[model samples]
Target chain A: EAGVTQSPTHLIKTRGQQATLRCSPISGHTSVYWYQQALGLGLQFLLWYDEGEERNRGNFPPRFSGRQFPNYSSELNVNALELEDSALYLCASSLAAGQGKPLHFGNGTRLTVT
Target chain B: GESVGLHLPTLSVQEGDNSIINCAYSNSASDYFIWYKQESGKGPQFIIDIRSNMDKRQGQRVTVLLNKTVKHLSLQIAATQPGDSAVYFCADYLTGFQKLVFGTGTRLLVSP
Candidate 1:
């Protein structure tokens, strides 16, 4: 089976602009999660979507939002992007949410905010 | 503000040697813990995981030890190889939560 896949391996956007990143979960996976990995920093949880609903989110601002489609694919949208937003955005999928299942991650989309 | 943190920022070990990375978590309620290896420009790959009820778990060449008493977790790699050079992270998940709180991370360097 294919692992999680992310689109736009690299994306560049100007400050104050909006950026959108996409993810496709592995086959038969129902939960998708988004995380941000800043340079030399650890992964920071962004959002969690399960069964087409937003189940949880991290301490990030409302400008960082995303949605999961019925097929379990997800899209993360960053509005009013700031320079600090330049980082690798990762997408992960699990068989289910809150089940202690190990998440499978995609290579990630490297977003550069200029 | 409580989060998971590593005991060291970086660890250097020789090839064919054993390597151990340590992490401390502040959330006592966290019941599930995972260790991930992330190479340059790549997402984290799951190395292994252990639950609160378990003290130690072993994989092919990796071992995870969880000490809930002192809230410490560790990952040990046997006969480390060059490919093992990467940043390793420890993450904790609460029983009913969907989010994972990651540790600062430890960079492992293997030298021949």
Candidate 2:
């Protein structure tokens, strides 16, 4: 089966602009998650969507928002992007929000804010 | 604060040797732990995971040991190869938290 896939492998946007990243989970997966990986840092959880509803989110600002589509795909939107917003955005999927399930991640979208 | 963190920023080992990466978490409620391997310009891939109920779990050439007493976890890779060189991260998750908290990550360097 195909793994999680992300689009626009590389994205460059100026400050104050908005950036959108897309992700498709593996088949039969229902939970989609977003994470931001900054240089020299670990992955920071951004958002979580399960069953088409926003279930949980990290400490990121409201400018960092996303939604899960009916098909279980997810879109992460970063509005008013700042220079610090530049990072690799990763998408992952799991069988469900249940405990003990490992997440399968995609290659990620490299978002560069200039 | 709920956070997972690595003890080492980098580790260098020779090929065919064993590699060990360590991590710790602050949240005692975290019952599940996972280790991930990420290559350059790529997202993290699942390597191995061990629940709080297990002291050790093995997969392929990798072993994950979890110690709830110290809130510590370790990933041991046997016969390390150059291909095993990458940034390895440990993550923790609570049963109802619905999200996994990741550590700072440790870069593993293997020399042939």
Candidate 3:
């Protein structure tokens, strides 16, 4: 089976612009999560969507939002992007939430805000 | 205020040697933990995981030990290889929460 897949491997946007990244979860997975990995920093959880509902979110601002589609694919939209927003945005999928199931992650989309 | 952090920022080891990376978590309520290996420009790959009910779990050439008493977790790789060079992160999952809180990563370097 294919693992999680992300599109637009690399994206470039100017400050104050908007950026959108996409991810498709593995088949049979019901939970999709978005994370941001800044240079020299750890993975920061952004959003969690389960069964098409926003389940949880991290410390990121409202500008960082996303949604999961019925097919379990997800899209992360960063509005008013700042230079600091330049980082690798990763998406992961799990069989379900709260099951302790290991997450399968996508290679990630590197967003560069200039 | 609860967070997961790594004991070290970097670890260097020679090929064929055993390598151990340590992490400490502040949330005692965290019942599940995972170790992830992230290669350069790639997403984190699941190395192994352990639950609160278990003290140790083993995978192919890798072992994860969870000490809930002290809220510590460690990942041990046997006969380390150059391919093992990457950043390793330990994450904790609170029982009711859907997201995983990741720790500051430990960069592992393997030398021949």
What does the lDDT read for residue A38 in candidate 1? 78
Candidate 2 lDDT (Cα, 0 to 1): 0.91
Against the true two-chain complex, what DockQ does each candidate achieve?
0.53, 0.57, 0.53
Task: Please list the C-alpha lDDT of all candidates, in the order they appear.
Answer: 0.91, 0.91, 0.91
Q: Show where candidate 2 strays beyond 4 Å.
A: B1-8
| Clashing pairs for predicted structure model 2, backbone only | none
Alpha-carbon RMSD, each predicted model: 2.1, 2.1, 2.2
lDDT of 1 at B25: 92
Choose 1 or 2, whichever is better by DockQ.
2
lDDT tens digits, residues A58-105, model 3?
999999999988888999999999999999999999998875798889
Q: Report the C-alpha lDDT of model 1 over A1-114, residue by residue, as the tens digit.
A: 889999999999999999999999999999999999877778888999999999999899999999999888999999999999999999999988874788889999999999
Q: What is the lDDT of residue A82 in candidate 3?
A: 99
lDDT score, candidate 1, position B79: 100
Q: What digit string (tens of lDDT, one per residue) describes model 2 on residues B6-110?
A: 444889999999999999888899999999999988999999998888999999999999999999999999999999999898999966778999887888999
